[model samples]
Target chain A: MLDFSLNKIFVEGNTDQKMIATILEIHYNISFPYNGLALEDCIINCNGWQGLFKQVALKEIYRIESSGKNLIIFDADNTSNLGGYTKRKKEIEVGFAELIKATKKNINYSIYLLPNDSDNGDLESFYMSCIKPDKRFFIECWNNLYGCLQSKNEARYELKIPKSAGMVYSYVDLFENYRTGFYQNKKTKRDYSDDGLWEYNFEENNHLKSLCKFLEDNLNLKSN
Target chain B: MPDQSEFITHFEVSNFKKFDHLVVNDIGQFNLITGDNNVGKTSLLEALSLNLKSNNDLVFKFHSLLCDQHIHHHAENKYSKNPIIPKFNYFNLLKNKEELPLTLVFNSQKVILTDIDYFRLKEEDKDLFVSTPYFMDGIEYKYWIRIDKSNVKPEIQFMYEDDYYREDRKFESKLYKPIVKFRNFYERDLNKFIKELSQIELLNLTAFDYEEIVSIIKIVIIPDIIAINIQKINNDSDEMIFIATKSSKGLFVNVTRFGDGVQKIIRYLIEVYYAKKNGFNYFLIDEIDTGIHFSRLKIFWKEFLMLATKLNIQIFATTHSQECIEAYAQALEELGMEEKGRLIEMEEHNGKVYASTLSYENIKAGLISNTNLRGA
Candidate 1:
């Protein structure tokens, strides 16, 4: 059986790539090689959905699927704030129908939506699902603080969630958000040391457990 | 010359050079042979050339196979150097078994070469010999076997069979013309076959080929060169030279004066032009991108692929450069000839040479990922 680390994770951009790598390493203790993943090994940073689709149109997906399992994780940016989950899910399904059809039916591959399969939001929302229930008060305080800051800010664009879900992740158990800046660069910096190894159980965390299951089942990964 | 393209669609070589046996089938119009050093890449080209054409061309390639210019000199004879030469038996796959004949199969035609004792040089009425200097003990005289442009004959053993004109009932036997070749610098008298082609009216180039060469040269070799002129050298022998017209300088310069890179570019271009014009079916080029720059390789391949396809020329070229392979793949993709271009990789396994054709997917992926296909 192939190692879990060999299973390729095709994601939107550098931020998702780093977040996924961090998640796998910190939580699952799986390490990736220097070069981005291919059949031989390395993470494939598709840059974005358009770039990822181009690779698919070029028949690269068939090549990947032939050699090993491919885990395609894209941002389901259809958050409840913008539109209802039901409407957004339909739009995503329709938009990606061609891709889903092109993929070989027998291949061991899966496409997972963020937060929940049918739910809106993205990797950020999914991280929010991993938050401890005890940190509910802190989440409320952070949302209020973000809302106040958003009103005062001159920047025109709306941040889907007022506060970064990654930033909120730092306050919870088993999560350490070391990432900072607009695009993960060191310019706008935040450094937080892990208090200790959180007493987190793999089976207890449903969101993370599902991701591990997908990796295990699709990749035929022999758990270490 | 035959009307239809006599380009070799397939060939099998055995007991020739390093390759004990190699059979390449489903060959494309353009075949690129590549591998590590001493992998029989050049020998494959030689095998193809010999398979497709006359014996005279094979003699020239055999001499310059290694391109080593080691001519032993003596204190007595100052003019020509004594070079150690090998006979036909030296080509046997198993060196100890000299009786085994080197076999070359082209399409359906098979040509078997035997002992060099059958061949002898004739200069006018006198018999030429390769004279060797006396070491300390004794003197030995030999036939002066010049690699190219030699009047060597096979002691008139039997009637010659003309493979091309075999169908024609008028002529009792068919006469064979040499296949086109653009060899590296080591091969002496590069114009021997080209000069012969020029002598034959039907096989000679048309004005259109000259125009095409001019146009191709503008993109491939020297941008400054406007035209090419085949001028007769004012020497005792009938020797022709190529003069490149410098457009900006408004003057013509001998092609020999150009650097190896420019000469290498022009060499293949000339072969391509001749093949296009005279309907020469096959061309064998060794180290096609020897002196050319890495960046210019793509430009060279683009022009080569387009011209070779347009002229229906079957090209078998060998290269040891990674850039050349990538450039070829890129050119094929750009020209929409990815299916037509074939990269034959040669490797030695268990004392025998093995050849495998790289698939389109492999070639494309290798190039995209910067994978080394040369297998060095």
Candidate 2:
């Protein structure tokens, strides 16, 4: 039913959708369609990366390109076995190159790998980069504690940067309940919510500039 | 009368072939069954066909299947006897007992095959039995048959408690015959079923508009086939042949000779067309993706979904191909029918077949994650 009349930004999952939606809203004051604000504008989270590679999604991308631009963002998922970041990113690009060319005559579309800086990381890495500077001290304390936990059990802290950053920005409730020391917290555990991080200083966040430009160009193209 | 519009929502097959007790539930309008080879996928389709109990066609079809397997075994071993026995191998019943009936239940309606009878001639009756001449000398065929031998018919009892039909109705009266006569509930239309199998010409069925027939077939078949029509060769009334014209060359070709893939496509199109036209409750197909190219499978499924949706007919198809299974998942999303499809994977655990019904969401997830739902 979504004929993609509105510029469609396809993401991997809800986390990416919500994060990008929040960014679009806070930075550019552009409310997403699913938020009961922008009925004619939104992000299309296809649930997982495979959905983007599916023929159904490919067909949808073509239809969306007819009247609007379609932006596809995927987690590089560049683990070590997949030949690391550069090769993995090239693989994805080459895989979709033919399909992209097939639809280019009728529609404009762009592919943006997550992290926006390198081809090797995921949305978690991007989220890590965009963490509010005000929470730096709490994050440092959390990292020190995570290091001690890792020294006790290395496997527990695998992929340290993303996981550590996740704890800082996502699990803010745990930090808020901390008593006096870093490891001392009340008997309370809560889910991660990305609501506050949307209002971070996007104007100075160089990591988000290309993505912002894509969204701005899409919006301008839609209005014209 | 069971609601003529109401289709089989679920089925439970017991003591049928390898399935001791296989129950498949949450059957949607479109279903793609996938599993390992010996997991009873074809048996599942046979069970559904038995539930329909359309006519004596199935009895003959089953006999042919058994005979083919038997003949192939002897043919493989040159030292085996030349006189091949033309006896119907007793149907496989649960616990290997002859009296145990193979039961097929479609919703609440049941078709039970009971009273096992095999045609065996007595010593005296054997003298009266004559060997029919084999016109082809290369193949030797021998069988025991008495001219006065009683037709060994399997006693099929259709038992249902639905009050919608007349209580005093005779099962014999509703028995499906080998002629094209439209009937509603409690009847199997064998001719209608055969018409679909032989690839019925769309022109013969006057119920459909000529333009509508061409358009639907165009979508159903390969892109090269631009149009379909029936040609009555030499003004002969019974000599109508299905024909298709290539888009680029305008060269017409007989539909049957157009390779298995095209024939399959045409067969499916005709089945859907007639099912809709005649208000058939269900369309049963085994290995729906057979002979279809992997790339064309998506096209086949997309067209199938469109036609089935238009007709409002429920389909039960079995497949072993992962491409076939994934095609359904892809079609559901493409057509925005994310909730209208279901994938049931059959498995054999401890010598008993069990069906694990997967919803569209589950199938999508399984496919994306590359999980082997098709079984080991």
Candidate 3:
């Protein structure tokens, strides 16, 4: 009911939003304008923070007390350098330190980069092996990574992405902009024609409104 | 000691009812004669008035209530350099115990009577001595002393303090009319004599003027309720007034609203004011530590006594509070009033009223040796 001109953030990515919010929420108990919040101000997710720890994002986070909600997130898709040759914890800490330095300017705009670049050296290869570069392909990759990361003891940065992105990401990623596919294990089909989920991808996930409210209310909560 | 400059050095009680053979000497600056409830603290005060000018009927009714017959009240005042001629007087009450021509002599002294004690008095005159002699009952006693000696007059003729304060102030006060001495009646004009007898003014005399101090005390002391308003009134076409406060609803509200500590502080301050304005002369307080919290009791003696000595009011009070005793002792030691003061306690000894002097060490021992404090 009140003016929300400076209240919240609206994220563009699913994994980036949930990972950054869920991680910080669990670790520090510090709430934020999660993925979906009712506000006029702009927002970022996990991918934003680890974006080379860019000076822009850092500046943005710090100005949040005045400017508004500042959220940051990063990609954990590539490097396995997270795990040390002998001492794995050291490698994770050093890697996180580097990422933390990049966004030191804003101080308030905290960053989140997951499944460290050091984790699971080759996730793209594994996800791509099962599914081709089609509509449901990244979805399949999201599901695989999500499930694998669920089992891994890696730092937040090292955790794998969801296989098929838990179907939740289909609403955000543009389906019409790319080709998509789904593996038919029963039919033993390699690439079923017209069986892609390109229509479901990049669609608005309306059911998530309540979920975002839950996140928003749970964190950065306004008390009566 | 130059007779200590007291106007009337001694009193003569004749047919003063129950006071048959009362001869107490050394009328010093502070005389504290205390005993059990009926052991005659009031009787002694009444006998002292025989030397001064006071109402005879009021004095007679006092003896009628005591129901004692024929007591002699004889006294010698320090008006002249002659101890040989004692100023004695006889107030003869008829055999009926009520009717009498209570005649008071100015400078008359029956040297024969002073030389001969009541043990030698004939039974008929002894009958004349007790009854119609001195007032004995508590209420029938009115303080209207007519001073015969000008320069040697009794500044404060006589006073009687009943144990009326503790026993339901509203109900028990009806036991008798409390002593409110009229200045003109007692040969003391209120405005003129006040300059001599007045003690140090606590803060300011006017309650309105003292609002600042009272308010500060209210703040730091945190009283449950505080009121400081002064009103001037006409008494018998003369100005008179009293200062009081609704202070609080009661102790219960104070404890919940502000704290027990604050209530305690306010109480101590009022008591200190009482002691300061009264002078180091005569104080008859029944219970010294009522509503006084234990934690703040220490301040009562340590700081309060310092103020008390300068005001010079000889404090005579009773206390069921062991802390009171302890505080008085500590106060005496700190203020060095121990050597200058006396503590007389009334206790029953073998069914007879007995009194004994208590020193600072005794007070300390009484406090420290109590079984309760040992465990605490």
TM-scores for every candidate against the unseen true structure: 0.52, 0.48, 0.29
Best by TM-score: 1
**What lDDT score is found at residue A63 in candidate 3?**
32
Query: Which stretches of model 3 miss by more than 4 angstroms?
Result: A1-224, B1-227, B232-280, B334-336, B349-351, B366-376
Residue ranges of candidate 1 with Cα displaced over 4 Å: A1-224, B1-9, B53-183, B186-203, B233-240, B244-249, B273-280, B348-352, B359-362
Model 2 lDDT, full chain set: 0.54
lDDT accuracy of residue A178 in candidate 1: 27
What's the best-to-worst order under DockQ? 1, 2, 3
Candidate 2, A96-204: lDDT as tens digits: 6765664443545667777773656777666656655655565567668777766676565564443523563454554454323243333222222343432255567
lDDT tens digits, residues A1-224, model 3? 22122333323243334433442344335344423331112233212212322222222221332443333323343324443223433433454466346434223332222222233312122223223234445555666666667678468677545433334334223343333544345232222122242121112332222233343443454322
TM-score of chain B of each: 0.67, 0.65, 0.40
DockQ metric for all predictions? 0.06, 0.02, 0.00
Ten-residue stretch with the least lDDT total in model 1 chain B: B156-165
lDDT of each: 0.54, 0.54, 0.34
lDDT of 2 by residue, B318-376 (tens): 77788988887888899999888988777665576667566787677656544455643
Query: For model 3, how does the per-residue alpha-carbon lDDT over B40-78 read when each residue is reduced to its tens digit?
Result: 444444434333222333343343333232343322332
